[model samples]
Target: MIGLVLAAGAGRRLRPHTDTLPKALVPVDGDLSVLDLTLRNFSEIGLTEAAVVVGYRKEAVYARKDELQAAYGLKLTLIDNDRAEEWNNAYSLWCARDVLKQGAVLANGDTVHPVSVERTLLDSRGGGRRIILALDTAKRLADEEMKVIAADGRGVRQITKLMDPAAATGEYIGVTLIEPEAAEALADALKATFERDPDLYYEDGYQELVDRGFRIDVAPIGDVPWVEIDNHDDLARGREIACLY
Candidate 1:
């Protein structure tokens, strides 16, 4: 299995810092960047190889690839998303489809969380579940959060940022375990999603899979503090929680 990171977005909300570096390279704690923490988490979880999808000032990542590899003791593969500045992450994730044959544990590069999040997805991977999403059922939902809804006693029914907060059971924490059995189907779904609308998110791909009768269940991260760094405020929150890891 491999570790995958979606680090392509421009993150315009984070200026100055993002002007020269990708959001993944933005420092959240001291001199350690978001990508640093992600690679560390993957290393701790026994993922020796990780594929990072890069775009938007990707040279920064290329420059530090060797240094990062040496620090984490993990092999790194850089996947370029040429359309990252024009499209959403569905296309970015689809670019790494060919490498996920052995199954993959994928996470957003901008999200700051403890290594426990990765451990939870890894520990819950059996029982024939092809895909398991790390969900934060304890977080209070807002309109911007990527929300999820369960089906009639089944797995995920839908995942979207447009869903009503009251109807959402939880926020999909941007971490997922994808068994090899579901990689191809997920790739196809991501393809269809991007072809339909380049602006759609990778979560839309999960919704497509759910609509196709695939079981994408959730692993609840109970009371585990995590923050998706999107702006100045989120960066502050990330700094506060990152030390706990």
Candidate 2:
């Protein structure tokens, strides 16, 4: 039951700031970076072993690994994603494939969500195929966010990333509670997507598995404190969320 933090994105939208530091190292509310906050939140839920995948400005992510290890008694592992500049979050997951076991919680390096995210994953009992955090995109309709089209009746059917605005349904909050077998299945598809088009995102893997009839449980974090810090606006949003700091 280890936690994996996917932080290998180039974060081009973050520009000069990202040029100097990884998004996980980006300061959230002075003295605390988003990565630190995320780990602290993990600690609250009793997750002390967190593996962070680093890419853009990888050194910055490594610098925190030691601090996090000493300060929290958490064993932080930094996996250098050599191809991070050429791949997507899915690729980052692929790099950590050797580490993630069954019943693991995976979050993005830039995701700043409530402490409850940890509780949600830990307490779920792993009864379903995959449990993921969903959010209402109705409020903020048009970001390049991964949106899911979830069908309410019978069971949940999620269609993620509608290129057309009218087709998108809900937003994916980048928090995942996954079964190792399912992850391996998804990773296989992801490898194909990356091999064909290395630049494509990991969501493409979901599209493949969903086509094969995999049903993922939707844990809607509707109106809860969650922010994916891809740019300046998100950083501001992170600042606004009630921090445990």
Candidate 3:
């Protein structure tokens, strides 16, 4: 399996920092960007090749592609998402459909988490599971967070940000393991998700999968130190915890 990163979105809330670089390039540790951490985590987990979906100042990534590859000791494949500025991540993810077909450990480029999160997903693989998401059962959920409702054996029944926080079992920590068998269907689901509403998140695509009777397993990353960097506050929080990772 290869590592997949969805790093196409333009974080408008992040302004000047994102004006030239994508959100993934925003540094959390001294000189290590969020993407750097992601690649490092992938490397640590034995995934020596990765595909990154890039847009919204994609040139910045192109400029640093070789440097990032050399630093991470991995091969980098940059996928282009032309509509990143106009659409949501459902499309960004779909852009890497071919790569996903090979199976992948997918991490949102803006998330800063330790290698443990990836390890948890990897450890939970098999037993006929096609898709496994890293769910954080410990974090207190808010309406803004992408919430999930999953049962022990039944797997995830619902995954969305619009759901009531009180009803959610956990928050999806922006990491997933996709088995090769599930990729085609997932790609189709993602296509339908974005075509229906360009503003919908890739999580919505997972919802689509559930709606179609796909069993998406959830692996709880117990009490992990992680942050999804959205705005400046998240970036600050990321910095505090990134060093710990």
Cα lDDT computed for each candidate against the true fold? 0.91, 0.71, 0.94
lDDT of 1 by residue, 110-180 (tens): 99988998899888877788999999988889999999997644889889999889999899999999999
lDDT of 2 by residue, 1-245 (tens): 67778887767788777788877877777767777777877777787688888888887777667788777667888888889887776677778776665456788888888877667655654555464544555446575778777666422455556555566666777777776666667677667767777777667766666777776665655567677888888888887873644
Separate clash counts for every candidate: 0, 0, 0
Best prediction by TM-score? 3
Backbone clashes counted, model 3: 0
- With candidate 1 superimposed using the best TM-score fit, by how many Å does residue 73's alpha carbon deviate from the native? 0.6
Select the stronger candidate by TM-score from 1 and 2: 1
Shift of residue 154 alpha carbon in model 2, Å: 6.4
The TM-score obtained by model 3 is: 0.99
Give the per-residue Cα lDDT of candidate 1 at 243: 83
Instruction: Put down candidate 3 lDDT per residue, 114-212, tens digits, no spaces.
Output: 999999999999899999999999999998999999998999999998899999999999999999999999999999999999999999999999999
The reply for model 3, stretches above 4 Å from the true place, is: none
lDDT of 2 at 65: 72
Sorted by lDDT (best first), the order is 3, 1, 2
Error of model 2, residue 158, in angstroms: 4.0
Per-candidate TM-scores read: 0.98, 0.88, 0.99
TM-score computed on alpha carbons, candidate 2: 0.88
